[model samples]
Target: MSSSLHSPWQRHVPQIQRKHQHWLTDTGSLTQKLKNHCEQFVVQRVRQNRAFLNLSETKSLCLPLGRRILQRQVLLICDDSPVVFAHTVTALERAGRDWPFFNQLGNRALGLTLFANPLVCRSDFEYTRICAQDALYQIAQTALHTHHFKVNLPRHIWARRCLFQHVRHQNSRMMVTELMLPEIYQLEKTSKAR
Candidate 1:
């Protein structure tokens, strides 16, 4: 199915519910937040390899379809529950120069590095609700299944993305997108009941 059939991303933050707003709009490191909320937090690297960016990504990064880029996919598990699927893309030429430690992030949370860096600037967030037919939805589900997580796929998954750029390096850009799993909202509900 085409991406047009799915919900398109919106830049408006107010569109999200107030409860989820805190999680979606927070500018702080997501890794740290997850750690605070869960007894165990782990980053499971699903795949890290060179790949071409999708059409939307290509347009966002101003690159062509055939252009090679470093693609990294990981699942952020909190308290043994898979809560988020994160996908990052960076132009191969700029990967090393912009994010020198990118290649070394083995099972390490990228949010910790990006948020800690004083030179890293993040663009306004864009939110979307992805259906089962979306490529990203399949990627996320596959990652979960690969990790032995029970996959009763949801009708739609909420996600957000933003572009990151090195302040001193104009050519260095990285796109990070995260799909929030059902466990995330379940955690929120449990916390509220406490």
Candidate 2:
């Protein structure tokens, strides 16, 4: 049985999706540059010969080899895959080394494993540093802003906080697979009321 009823904007959804896809692909170079910048920060800070970084569609930080990697120094930061984040932690702990590299990382080394996905584990902690995004400071600048009836600011902000909060609690791991569509069905009515 067909679950969906005929929707007026069924045709428009595809167009909107195409636009977003185009935007990401067009900015692919810039995204790569951004990822490179993030890597540079870690490389510059850690003076380790054996360092491995993982980049995937879902963005996850992972340890290259499980038990074999115990002797080497590895730091993982997975933006597209939180599963990598969880696994890295588990592997590191299993390796059972305090890892001198942690001295170089300092506080930056404390938190990096994300638990929200449940796929990531604390054992990867030896090689993975769990860190949470500074959502409040990141949004505090525009905490109070002009209203855009087309976009509900309150709900948007709340959702962002919720996601950030949940991820932080789980070792700052976040994998945004889908866009959070704004509930602006009443946008026209809200705009008219104003």
Candidate 3:
């Protein structure tokens, strides 16, 4: 007789579905697809800005392989916002598998940024622990943690999505999107090239 639906969990259905969608989207997209998009977007932007690199555009950047390259170096940019509720390390691992070169080049430098720093939080602790177990390149966080590789976490922008609109200031954004990672690397290359 009432206007309510028969479903018991209907009230939370939207939220549950949203989370599932996010997971599926992130997991379904491959790293190469992300990297390719990033390359095109970043290159176009750089060209417009008069700061483009002269790398071999024809040659596809084949990512390295195995533990040798894996131990070479890596820089992980994590926008560790509580609202971005998804498995962080697990997702990164999948990305690595998807793009062996991207992960191998980093060797193991993992960088993290939280939207809001939390003290004694279980999520924070677990994130750190999982990253360590993964043999990350290096783990840096805003929160105090006793690690041999701790460094001053850099400024980063956080957003609900990785699109340009969702991104804030480029100079201070975390840029956690898998596609954007290569763009970040390209920028670093440009800086060095300059």
Candidate 4:
């Protein structure tokens, strides 16, 4: 189930825990899954801004260097607890023309929109274990700090990303990433104990 995505010297690939594997491997709407699991599921928009794409992002979206994109961050809240941190990016021009709702979708689950739309097609999932040195993880850590939502991070966090393309619009490419927060593990443990 594990293929070498990074170079050998980059650090041995982290093993996926059994509990997390089911969640991570599910390709269906994560928003729905969270809703089904919790009594109350909410989407809290954390950040939505225009910024230059990172190297990994630029490559994923097949965009040239120095191109700016609309970046969004959201926390998936289950039973008033933040269980997942989601990040997404789309080209600036495509944000309006292709995804007209991107700007207007405040506190709405992006997964629902993408999955419900008939025009959108998702790519295979790509996963990575993020640690202190990962830029994206650092960004998430800083955001959680400023928001005052205290959640301690484990040594590594599992993250998955995929590209969603609009069948009608050739250039309509969007990359969505979701990170499993430590709170998610706690949530599962608590539910099982009940």
Candidate 5:
């Protein structure tokens, strides 16, 4: 029941279900994998604003002394049901120069752009459990309410994160965190029953 977002992100969480671990460790394109999970996969953009990221995020992205960064949050919806919550942070100063398409990705998955670039290199995946008090969990709840999704999310969720860095300018990179929402398991169950 750890409520801190600063909880260490590990390579694996042995206590979670094997199914949950499957999704967390998949290094392939998440946007593509999600497309196969439902008839329709959509990226619902929740918020994209300038703000200071939490300490963990700031350090992961290697941002300068508490500088403002671009924070974008989205819910990956499958057949109208939200399945995953995603948060991304890029230094506002270098965003356009480094992550040129980040600001233009309206409802499109950021994974699409990241995976397509040959100049970008991704680091290893790190796993984390997000409890109710964590900002990420709170954002997921708010997204559910705002979108009027009837699904009841759990008090905690499992999320994985990694950094996408520019091969040319190593310091210019973005950190992406994705949380598998509870409804995702429901969808998996229903799909298996079919």
Candidate 6:
């Protein structure tokens, strides 16, 4: 991953609309929120495979290079609309030992599992805004196209990330990053109008 792509992850939430800020700062399960928002909710597993962790991810997980890790990317859809694109990474060794379900979570909301566990402790949120040129922006665009969401693409997208650590196991940690799509804001507007 390019350093520029990870350049703007802020420890504090950026100046954004209150609707977007609510989604970014919420400590609750995003999966549950999506379920509540739409009659149809789906988790689309876009890609899940062994890959080398990026520099920021390696530093967060305290793992060295050459050791492959499990990287899973999924799209959270509500009412047939792609609302969020999530990218998750976990150390392969620690995942198998600590989070055995990491490999088996296909088309299932990882948030449901993580939030349900009392032992899973999440770090503070880090916010960022991604432009069209960013890697995550391209991924979100592709997901929207693949899912056939008929919405206008904005020049930039807002995102947030955090590190989740298992309380009992010190070495077990997973980094999850979520990119909020334009349709999410549209949903908020529609709900408010209703």
Please name the candidate that would achieve the greatest lDDT relative to the true structure: 1
User: How well is each residue in 74-128 modelled by candidate 5, as lDDT tens digits?
Assistant: 9999888888989898888889898888889999999988999999999999987
Which pairs in model 6 have colliding backbones? Answer: none
Q: Which ten residues in a row have the lowest lDDT in candidate 3?
A: 42-51
**Model 1 regions more than 4 Å off:** 1-5, 14-16, 188-194
Cα error, residue 4 of model 2, in Å, equals 27
Residue 133 alpha-carbon offset, candidate 5, angstroms: 1.0
Query: lDDT tens string, model 2, 88-134?
Result: 22223432232323334432422332222334333210111111232
**Please, what are the lDDT tens digits per residue for candidate 6 over residues 42-161?**
999988988877765667678885558888999998778888999998888788888888889989999999998899999998888878777667876786777677655688788888
List CA RMSD, all candidates: 2.9, 18.0, 20.2, 5.1, 3.2, 2.8
Off by over 4 Å in 4: 1-14, 188-194
- The local lDDT score (0 to 100) that residue 1 gets in candidate 4 is 9
Top-scoring candidate (TM-score) = 1
**Between candidates 2 and 6, the lDDT winner:** 6
**CA lDDT of each prediction against the hidden true structure:** 0.84, 0.23, 0.21, 0.79, 0.81, 0.81
Q: What alpha-carbon RMSD in Å does predicted model 6 have with respect to the real structure? A: 2.8
lDDT of 3: 0.21
Models ranked on TM-score: 1, 5, 6, 4, 3, 2
The residue-level lDDT of candidate 6 at 28 comes to 88
lDDT of 6 at 78: 79
Question: Candidate 1, clashing residue pairs?
Answer: none
List model 1 lDDT by residue over 1-194, tens digit each: 12333586788874666777777777777888777777778999999999877766777787887788999999999889998899999999999888999999999999999998999999989888888888878888988998899966788878888999999998789999988888876664235224
Per-model TM-score on C-alpha atoms: 0.91, 0.17, 0.19, 0.87, 0.90, 0.88
Winner of 4 and 5 under lDDT: 5
User: What is the TM-score of candidate 3?
Assistant: 0.19
As a whole number from 0 to 100, the lDDT of residue 168 in candidate 4 is 96
